[model samples]
Target chain A: MAARPADTPRGRVPRAEREQQMLDAAVLVFSRRGFHHANMDEIAELSGVSKPMVYAYLGTKEELFIACLRRESARLVAGLAAAADPTLPPDQQLWRGLKGFFEFVGAHRDGWSVLYRQARTQQPFSVEVAAMRESVVEVITDRLDAALRLEGRQVKPDDLTAMALTLVGASESLADWLADHPDEDPGRTATRLMNAVWLGADQLMRGVSWRPPA
Target chain B: MAARPADTPRGRVPRAEREQQMLDAAVLVFSRRGFHHANMDEIAELSGVSKPMVYAYLGTKEELFIACLRRESARLVAGLAAAADPTLPPDQQLWRGLKGFFEFVGAHRDGWSVLYRQARTQQPFSVEVAAMRESVVEVITDRLDAALRLEGRQVKPDDLTAMALTLVGASESLADWLADHPDEDPGRTATRLMNAVWLGADQLMRGVSWRPPA
Candidate 1:
């Protein structure tokens, strides 16, 4: 396949733009070929850059894969952060965050697959991906804490973290489901998750709990 | 490393017992080497069987991986089923299932990793692994439906399935976390999930919904 033109007037592309181009190519390649099978040679070819340029810009295939993960993760996190309005009630904030998340995943299916599916499965990248996931969880945990404080309700920090992690996990799994079933609406996915989590969380905040029938 | 004796009699072993042994070896190897890197030769060496024997018993590497997934998934499902007493209320049934799930993961980290972390990321094995996850979700969905019915409340069937999927995803993610932090209590993980999911579910059953503060 003929390479896509690399930015601008023809000869030399700016470093920033070139880096983005390489990352775009790397995400596609890594998503298509599982990390082990994906090669820098193909990535370079697809990015319309030389092999040495690819190395100079990204270091190694591992680094390039991590770069792709970080970029996609940052985009996702930033999108959620932008969508969540703190002034709004906690549930609305969560709804906005979920909507941003599903929309991002729906738009960037390859990025979602690479970060959540491919990068996560490999052992070497686990720490990096875990850190990314932790940041998202931390955001959720903070929100849950803030919401609880508003109601004068207290919960253990660990419990809050677990709740945050579960919310993140549920969103992720549903995002994967959304990724596969492209016809499914992201808004509906977001609503489904919001209903599952927020309603449950609101109950917990009210000190309501389910007990086994005697 | 010297292989463990498949059967102590130094003669032909029963097919069922021998299959279990091979499956155990396959789970370890697959978890360590991943499906692509894992080979029949290493599996045979680990299982104290010949390469031909490995193929004859399990068919091929793909089939062997699927067999391993099936076995692990079955064990997990069985454990949950056994723990969840139908005589108990739905919340308690869910609690029991979650407890059984965490206990199973804590006891069999390798099996959990293979079925969840390793097998799930690859494209070729998605269908098989998905089916395994679906069964667990189906069980959760049924319980949620039953509980809702007992409460004289009703929700869309699709919503019930979505809730079940979220719970499964949350539990699986927490299980992954439990596998990583070996010291973390599985019961605590289960409780955290029960709090996050069941509380919200009960609230929804009572027609409680969270809306943005006016």
Candidate 2:
């Protein structure tokens, strides 16, 4: 049998391969150009496909954005899920989870940027983006809840969730900040974050006050 | 004297008033529709002026977006600068600055959203936006440095700055979260943030840890 032509379609590639190509292109384009600045034309161009093919496969720009969000969010959440164990000690669990987060973000900086930064800011796309964020928060909150219980502390779920949001937001902001200054080691970055957060959690658990220096 | 028409000649209207009106409209449009999605037409409509009028006053879409960013960022920085004092204890200074931040966000939600959300997400704007963020971080780092110094801590400036960025980011994210969940009071939001952050700072100073439950 003759080898398949490299340039031509091999009896039409599978849907999965096409979708992955689109998503990979979308993540790269969205990260470099951002959501508002990136056009479907450009995305289609980068994917080496016609605009019609892109629309046929990915639906509208909004749907394409949602698909990107879902894929990236799922990846990061899965990575974090593997690292954070309810049964592990609170400190160790937090450390591992942070390391996982930093590692995921470091490896998939483009995907992370698209999900964390681009997808979040535009309108007509915020509800789904917000829902994705809520899902991530739920995961972090679950680990936090277990950690709190493991520490023999019983805080209100809402309050604990809110605090978890604060921690997660800080890490995200730090990730962006860390991107600019890559000289710092990743392990140290994770440890610093864990220290900043675990320090706060400990005080809250023990009912300690942070008084200003005299 | 006869009253003048509202659409008086450019010479008749003070430049300051006209600029302020233009900025107000720009903030609303940019925040609601995003940078690229927001067109000059809507800004002119919302400002009750013609498209030519907007162009004449603000130059171009890019310039107008930058102007809105500068105005809002200056207002926020000025508010925080007024609240932060290096001589004051870190806790007191942080408490005061956070109070100012929540108040500023509550009153100027549109402008705040434009700066914090819209500007940061879109590219070609990140440079200008990062400057604003850096200024805000400067204010935050000042207080963090003092707080750390008081407890005889010797963390590197970059590390402390990273911590401050994390806190600032958490507050920004929380502010957006609060905007949606209106039942949460703004007055107490700053205090809650302080409790979480400052309490953690205190614990870090003392090297305390929250261990797993037996």
Candidate 3:
């Protein structure tokens, strides 16, 4: 997908369109060559834009990588938000949301490696990734709160955060596993986690407990 | 806890004891100063050993940090192993393991921060941290397999992995939160996760699924 200038004349292409091409190029290059080995010169060439233009538009390689991280994470967050419809029952909403999230990760294995493997552990970028994660957590907490309210039940803020953290944490751990195992089905993972979590949460909320089998 | 030389002769102390002292100082310094800002001179000074002695015992700052990570993770792993007495039933075993883990994290919040927050996302060290986490996963998986066998039941390896991943990932996420909230009880965190996971696994094994509330 080397810089296709939106069917417009090359020189007259809109700045926004041109910038997107550069970003596309950067994402592909970074994902393939890794952040350190990925060269700006190649990114500029692949995007069909000049080096100075790439710089003027996107700053340095670090800034460009951050841009890629932001775009990819935003795409993920948006997908999750759209998947959980308010009209649906709480359990359906959760199930759909998990399915959608896993599908997105399954489809974008390359994007995940760059965002999670590289950006998550590296400096400055890790902060960005953390902020992104916090947003996802907030979305989950809000949905849980809303779902419980629909049942005319209320949970303490701390308990809600605990529940959200469990979901987010378990999803991330499995997501990392999903990226590693190409043979694994993304939907199955979602189902596995849903089974592991939602059912347990429902049971716990109903005061169900598991004891040692005597 | 600045370097307490044993009551016996200083230079006459055994190599193993000396190394332990150095490791103790390194863990303290790394936890307080972080990886990038931590220096060897301070660690040596704190441990009551010379800077050169630290170099001889540990290779470099990177190696020292790795050593610290290894020791801390080992302590955690051992605590978990010791807590989950196999003589107990499966749920009890799991509950004990999780409680032990969260209690360790709560007690050594600084060690948790260094081992998790810093080592997990940073390079070279991230790989070390992952290896440590894998060992933990193995421990959890093995216990799960044992527990099932006692019940005269068997599970597929992949299913066991998924179950272990859920527990490890959820615990790590909550542990991070636990470190942040000093007021939070470690025992409660363990109980919360057990309710979120173990009960769910027990139900799923019984072929139960959570449906939308009508």
Candidate 4:
């Protein structure tokens, strides 16, 4: 059953609804087969539309991938942004952000895979996905900046950026780990991370150095 | 130039050496091109040999990937294992082992990428790579066990394993972050981690945790 009107045939389907259906199918197919192995034919078939209809709505396979990435990236970033509370303390803000990340990935497994694994391999998609990654990192850096400044400690912007990136990577790696062990709670994951980063960082900011054993 | 002699060429080159070379090339190429995109032709070219030579030396593409993964996995294990001294206190041993992990990745970026990025994809590779990943988690568990025992604390084995996995994932995430910012020394990285994991873990073992700032 074609979601688009039969009379408005070929490449002329309603731009909005057609795009949504195509992206839904793209997420499913790409997650199952990955980028290189996934074919346009399968996407069209799964979307309940003809090949040309799929192409018209989504452009080339590359464009279809970008669309999928853009949609998912927006969803994740929006979720993180929405979860933030500027009124809350820095650690609480960071914890909310990390919890949102894990919860989002758990609920949207296919979307996360497309963004993290599938989009990373394809050429143009990688650059586009990376920009979204930078946005997320910047969000974390801004929070870390406020946190460190409150303690009268200031790290170089570059170090802050690296720390943000490390936190993001760690969250991602842990999210995947949590995926495998589904019984674990996101709150616990976030707590573990805060202990690793914020607690240690507070001590460092206070000039408390952990010395190596002699 | 062909490494194997004609008469004994069929089985000529010592299995260990040839296998090492093949894996070396495979890690470099696969890390760059990823699994599905990496071609045997390119791997053969990079290895200073022929396509047939790769097949002869390392079996199919999947097999070569496994070989590369196995080689890198062994190096990571050995590096950390040698550095982790059971004779030392548990905290010191964990610090040493994590330091070894960061240093190993710093010296071998290609191997790290192959093991982290490429191996997690799917199929014949994932089955073994997942196992390799589990062993790494086990190494962390061993360190956790020693540390907890010394402190006269007892916890569920599975909980410790999960936390250990969290630490390893954090280290790995930090490694990838450090790769982009080369100025961050592994010693500094190790110290940061020691503060994060060892200090917080020490506090947790003593049943102390920072509460919400109200």
Clashing pairs in 2: none
Clash tally, candidates in order: 1, 0, 1, 0
Query: Where does the lowest 10-residue lDDT sum fall in candidate 1 chain A?
Result: A205-214
Candidate 1 lDDT for residue A191: 77
Candidate 4: C-alpha RMSD to true structure equals: 8.1
Q: In model 4, what lDDT does residue B183 have?
A: 70
Please say which candidate is ahead in lDDT: 2 or 3. Answer: 3
Choose the strongest candidate by lDDT.
3
Per-residue accuracy of model 4 over B1-214 as CA lDDT, tens digit each: 6555544553556667766767778888888888889999999877667799899878899888888888788888888889888887555676778778888777776666655655554555667866887798887778767666666666576556556666777786677666655677776676566655545533422334433112
Summarize candidate 4's per-residue lDDT along A134-189 as a digit string, tens digits.
Answer: 88888878876776676556767865665676677667767766666667777666
In model 2, how large is the Cα lDDT of residue B98? 79
Q: Which ten residues in a row have the lowest lDDT in candidate 3 chain B?
A: B205-214
Task: Judging by DockQ against the true structure, name the best candidate.
Answer: 3
lDDT of 2 by residue, A1-214 (tens): 5764556663376788878989989888877887767789989987778899899999988788888888887887898899887777566677787788887777766666655665555555666677877888899878776766656666677666667778778887888766655576656677666655656623322333222112
For TM-score, the strongest prediction is 3
Candidate 4: residue A104 lDDT (0-100): 81
Candidate 3 backbone collisions, by pair: A121-B121
> What tens-digit string does per-residue lDDT give for candidate 2 at B1-214?
5886877776776778888988889888888887778899889988778899889888999999989888888988898888877677565677778778888887766666656666765556767887888888987777676666666665578877877887788888778766655577665677566656656633422434222112
- Report the C-alpha lDDT of model 1 over A136-203, residue by residue, as the tens digit: 99988887777667666666787677878898889988888788877878888887786666557334
Could you give candidate 1's per-residue lDDT for residues B1-214 as a string of tens digits?
4664546662567788788989989988988887878888899988887889889989999999989989888888888778777777666777888888998898877667766777766656767888898899887778777766766667687767777789888987898888888888888788777666756633422334332112
Q: Which runs in model 3 stand beyond 4 Å of their true positions?
A: A1-8, A201-214, B1-8, B200-214
Better of 1 and 4 by DockQ: 1
DockQ of each: 0.33, 0.28, 0.44, 0.18
